[model samples]
Target: MYSALKAGFLALPYLSLGALAALDGHCPPLGPVLPAPTQPSKHEAVPAAAAALRGIIDQVTATYNGSAVAIGVKSIHESKLLFEYAHTPANKEKRGAQKVDSDTVFRLGSLTKVFPVLALLKLKDRGVRLDDPITKYVPELRGLKKQAREDSPVWVVDWDEVTLGALASHMAGIPSDLITDIAPFGNLSAYGYPPANTSRMLGCSGFFGTAPCNKTAVAFFEHYGQRPPAQVPFSSQTVYSNIAFPILSFAVEAITKRPFAEFVTNEIWKPSKMTRSFTTKPDDALGFIPPKDIWWDANLGFEGPEGGYFSTINDLHRFFDAILLNKLLPPAQTRKWLKPVTATSSTGLLIGQPWEIFRAENVTSDGRMIEIYTKTGDLIAYHSILVLIPDYDLVATMLLAGPEVSGSAMTLMLSRIIQTLLPAVEQAGKAEARAAYGGTYVDKATNSSITLSLSDDGPGFSISRYVIRGVDVPSTDPGSTLPPATPPRLDPPMRYRLYPATANSGRQTSWRAVGTRGTAAQVDKADAQIVWPMASCLTWAMMDRVTYNMGARDHFVFDVERGKVKGVEAVGYGVFMKKEC
Candidate 1:
């Protein structure tokens, strides 16, 4: 998901901050009931942690050819700012040395959408239904009859099923960019003339050129307001839309009457004391998400609610903390804001309001899995991510100022940083009873999913099974929009013997690839057909090589389902696999 090949998941440094993570919470929580982020221990390892973290940033900048980066990591469980690093190249082509800090402002890219979604959720809390037709608020979207043409450029939205919830959750069938509606992988390169993803419609130099643009993002909205819908009905796929949020802004404005920025400022920012946060004007912060690595002069009249704000780390942190801490929204509203819109998504993770619901694999000492609610924002010049470990009361954020030349360089850096700084959840105490956590829970969301075989060491099942590749990437390029050939045969499953508490001599799980099996890569190489007793040992050899160091460690999440094992989240080589029955 972070643009790294699945194989990249296995290559992180073998450092764990588990013991250090047990340190008492020195930082304060975002709210009263929430736990504070874990503070750095006075255990003398803090210096090493800082050094290693800085070294990683230095290495990443060097390899990735970045201009500057600002990163901050803290435990949301506590209030301490554990680590902060800001670096800019010494000699930057006549652009003097820039040292960013907590006060520095950053262009949040699509992350700006979270603010409108927050406003929407606040309205929802006040009895505004998400299921209401979008036209109810923005009357401009009413009664636009479409006449089919032999060939047309601009497409209209299906005004019928376009609900507030669908638009908010990115299921409204809206195009991703205001310019080009589609930029699917392989169909187009990320950097073509007038690339759809990061085209700046701001100043003269906005659209990868010097001459100022004659139009603004407003034109697209006006045209779409009267355009015809695409051929397909609006359902079944979550298309990330830059235009949808602005349309949402229109809906929000119709409800509030005041300007969107003013409404947010008066309603959310000022109340939370996020004084530095802004949707317009007087932001002199040196940080910039330059479009195409070319800086543009300030022109707020162009870019609108889609992504127009420049914010600080602490301010954005405060914004999220306010939501979590119940300063901005109540617990129920916050939960609704973070809930995924499953009707429009196929992946395990999907959008909640405007945030993404993503969980990685790892267990607490008590064998509980941690769920990380997160959002990653990427502009051409800036890249940022906010990861919330709700269970551990931790929030990790990273913002980089430079071109996202490859992809998600910040994601990889932040991932390593999270792993290095935050300790794995304390392994749960073991039970002498076999199959203590064994149960049959079904996850219809996925097929050929985890099938448990519970046995009794005492009254219950005696042992467990474990599987290789906690996450399975088919070795086929995901960017291709091709149809599947045939479903691969389900191989025999391996059960885990979860680590026990009272037993000092026993280990939780082990692996044995007992039978002949082919990996997705091997099958794809053979035209989606598996050869019995496969002659090639290549795939297995590679898998063994990959897993020798980075293997799956299983965790069972309880709070998710209660009283039952519910499901198993497997982590291998940085890949997280969901195996819930």
Candidate 2:
């Protein structure tokens, strides 16, 4: 939840390239795009490189609880990294520190789903349309619709209607996860994080309890294709699902007439020269789950399509380089690699495919807005996040002990490294941007207030900050713990970073609620409860996706006359906040 930009303007990651130089040029070495326009080599970055590296290590180590945490930040235009920080100490010395470098291999969880998507993109380029149904290719599911008998216990809303596009976008009505109530895991179904592999996974509650062949990926799909789904799939959703990935992979495998692994090795991996990356195999690697005592090797087994690949930072950088360099796929097809599968989420976010598309609010130091075509993955032992930032020509990736890391923590760690490597800007261009929308505004109808100021940090031009109060805050529970004197406030305020939407939106910034503050004189989640009787009956997922307050409109509209600020709408919870400044 922490933004590295908040670490003041100076904190940056130091380049730990001691081991990077050892791994020389790749065969058919990539073109010069990655290393061009390079600044002075990392060593000459003024104020000494030691502080930056040490600052990065200290920041990460402060939160990283496990034995090994490796990170890499490199420019898409340059082969060398701006910074690479790896800390692994066995018994606190962190074992395998040397062995776990840019070249060390580790399981890349759901990221494995990317290759199948890549292959599908290639096929799409070759006349395989995306809108067609999977039945068009497999024929195994040609006649199956949401058919169910009177005695059927589960709703058959998802069968027969799933398309290749749906499968790829996770909109196929497949359950959010791949884990089943039956099999290798006993009671985890009580919670949602399902087992990564479906080999021993069996259906119990939703649809496939008595599914005859519940062992392999092929069998599970066959079982579902022949039957009805447990839940409804008509609505396009960005929910997580390992079920759709393997099915998509099967479709790719069928079309290519080659094993997924073999095809990728020849067409994707070998061409990119990612020699260190592998499938279901370890190359002198160690996965630390609970290094408090020992480690465990998390296996993908039949989840190969979902998460069975092992790769390193070096090969990962090279792989992205290949894509950017137009070695594996052309720029046009590669661009499709990051396109949104569906419109489930807001702009800048696309789910269910290999790379998670998030257009970040914060701009790079060089003033370019960032579109993060990134993916986060985890086995029982290893967790990682890899991203390709096309606009800045940057790629940052990292992997570490999973059990000891939270997804937010991992993201923050990477953000810390990324914040430093990005081109630095001395002062924000907030004054001009703010003149039209800055200062205090009050909503007389609701007795609410909003205070907007030029952000003191980050890229100044495109960012603003606001603290809202009164009706702007969600309603509190009828029976609350606090006294009447205490009221809800926006607390630390939220960052209103400007983003480009339509041509009009391009003139201003489009932002949403993203930051969080600590539990210090703040409105609590439990306190903001809905008092309606039917509110309790709403499903968790339903409430999560449905938007209540869009924080004004999708874009901020400012009313200005001559040089004076007038009013603003479609922001915060205010219907209209007239400028009072």
Q: What is the C-alpha local distance difference test score of each model?
A: 0.49, 0.52
Best by lDDT: 2
TM-scores of all predicted structures? 0.59, 0.57
lDDT of 2: 0.52
lDDT of 2 by residue, 306-371 (tens): 776878878888888888778876766665665656554576576635557775545443332345
Give the number of the best model, judged by TM-score.
1
**Residue 456 deviation, candidate 1, in Å?**
20
Model 1, span 1-581: residue lDDT tens: 33343344234211110011110201111111111223334324544666777787777677444456677766554465667777654433233225567766676666777777777767874567878878888755643334223234345455556887777777777555534333322235545644444332322323333332222243443334443443233456566776667777777788888788888898899877787777763434445433334532333233356666667778777777777778888877776676666543333365677677754533222222245677777556666677776644566777666653323666678667766665421111112121334444333334323333323221112223332333232222111122246433332222122231111212233222111123335334543243432222221222223231355232222222333233444333232234343
Instruction: Output the lDDT of residue 203, model 1.
Output: 23
Error of 2 at 142 (Å): 4.9
Candidate 1: C-alpha RMSD to true structure equals: 16.0
Instruction: Kindly give the stretch of ten consecutive residues in candidate 1 with the minimal lDDT sum.
Output: 16-25
